[model samples]
Target: MTSNDATRQALIVRGGWDGHQPVETTDSMIPFLERNGFAVRVEESTAIYADADYLATVDLILQVNTMSTIEKDEFAGLQAAVLNGTGMAGWHGGIADSYRNNADYLHMIGGQFAHHAGKDPAERTGEQSDNYIPYTVHISELGKTHPITQGIDDFDLVTEQYWVLSDEYNDVLATTTQSVRPWDAWNRPVTAPAIWTRQWGKGRIFVSAPGHRLEIIENPNVRTIIERGLLWAAR
Candidate 1:
């Protein structure tokens, strides 16, 4: 189909570490997009860079990869596509934690997965990990009424609660407060954003810090949040 006739095309990039279970996670997302009338193309290899022209034709980009780097030209094309109105959306460390060497990429994403505080300290290296714990997310005042979060009740999750250091300009959708433990040496409590969306040029970025495992993404509330975030972030 021609570019004008391909409004439903979506590019799903899946690679990097197996811990994120890129293949399985992205496989699970196919039906959801299909149901929503999206013609999804799952690219397990990063060779899409060889044909940068084709990547620009997609309407939405969902990255399920983690801790991998892309060539500068390939990364630039994707960034430009999003900035020019293509939707960019992902959950957890896949998208947010990707392209650590590319500052321009981080600028497009709006925030980076900094650290996680819980039982799995050493395992929680970089952006992706198996740090599961029960926590509550407090909807940000600005996002309490946003479409991505409207009518969603405050929820709890037994998953990795990300402590993301975000750009001050982000439109925070929701946040989870991290309470200080009595045994912990840190004197003050820290509050972190659990989910957020931000506008970059003519495009959009949506991120949620949950998907550590298939079970976590299987949660009804988490599913809804991810679905809504995908739609909300689409241009």
Candidate 2:
């Protein structure tokens, strides 16, 4: 692609649960791309199928969708585009909790938010028992050496601590351990994968489970990790 081609391109898709704050989350990233010379385009719907070739011209794909079902053809177009070298990156439920019925989507993303086994339960009872319960995220062994995590340290946040079921194929960047409560638990302590990167064909995929809201993304460390991850994933 020529400079003109690159200058004319950017693709951003945002939809799904309102709680995840897709609109606010993706809007926050628009200026970043614009500053980097991308002509950012934001889509409020997931109708990426209407222009299947749009991904072909895009320099990067920023998805802020969560827990939404995608049609086969639409997802196939995205899968092919990413595999063919269109960059893919997203954080939290937007990426990890997206397209639950599509195994291919999950495969490309490398993991899914399985359960939160620490303080919050699957079923909330009290006012303070929501999934948005706060906790600190520890930067584990692998984070020290990864480009996306370079200079980043252990950070604290008041967001959902993702308990992800990740494929061993991923290059895990960070992790947080959650201790199981014996009274309500089924197993021993399990370590959760917090951030990861993986390759799909000639393209790249990045997942970060921190941005539950715009405020969560505002954290300097979280923002830095996401900013680096987006660039790293893009071609």
Candidate 3:
């Protein structure tokens, strides 16, 4: 497909932990955005967040960034743009774990990655506890009707069960449960959100917790949800 620079604009700012393969993950989504009529640009730095005037011109932001610190003004500009109607979407730690110290950013995104209950994959030199665990996601009744999740059934992922500090504001679409194990500090299976959408002013926010690796992101249902979610979020 040809780039339609006049249709819409998107910015993908990616970096932080290499374990998440931010570059590769962000690269994989460029074609989707382009195919959907967005002229996408990739950036390696969060400094782009400081450019409010330029940000105002963007229609969407797909961030595959991780625990990178954001300058106060840069963070502020990002919040302003989203609140002013620029759509935001991301998966896993890229969106949920960004900026450990930025509360406003978390509020806009609607959640924060607390910690993964499982050990990290041995191949990666990052945080390790429980790296891979099989879990099933149950689609909510609302999800069956929501455009982002329409026709997608409940699926399973053998990745980390993200235990996020999320609020009730999100329009949850799917959920997963963590059965209490000997390693768990708490007993009883706990259900947590796997996919959700939220609003920040006039902008749309979509998040999915399953994309820990390229394979998971490439899953048919995962790809469809992410693609449709981004398109839906865009102005």
Per-candidate Cα RMSD to the true structure, in Å, reads 3.7, 3.2, 2.7
TM-scores vs. true structure, each candidate: 0.88, 0.89, 0.93
Can you rank all candidates by lDDT, best first? 3, 2, 1
Which window of 10 residues has the lowest lDDT sum in candidate 3?
A: 120-129
Question: RMSD in angstroms, candidate 1?
Answer: 3.7
Better of 2 and 3 by lDDT: 3
Q: TM-score rank, highest first?
A: 3, 2, 1
Tens-digit per-residue lDDT, 172-196, candidate 3: 9998887876766878877788899
lDDT of 1 by residue, 1-235 (tens): 1133344888888888788777777777777877776788888865674466786677778887788888887877887788788888888888878878888888888888887666645555555434566789787777678988888888888777888877787888888877676645567888777888878888888888888767777888778888888877766
lDDT of each: 0.78, 0.81, 0.86
Number of colliding residue pairs in model 3: 7
The CA lDDT at 34 in model 3 is: 89
Name the runs in model 1 displaced over 4 angstroms. 1-7, 120-130, 182-185
Candidate with the greatest TM-score versus the true structure: 3
In the range 112-172, model 2's lDDT, one tens digit per residue, is 9987543535456654236555566777677787889977888877767888988789988
142 in model 1: Cα distance from truth in Å? 2.5
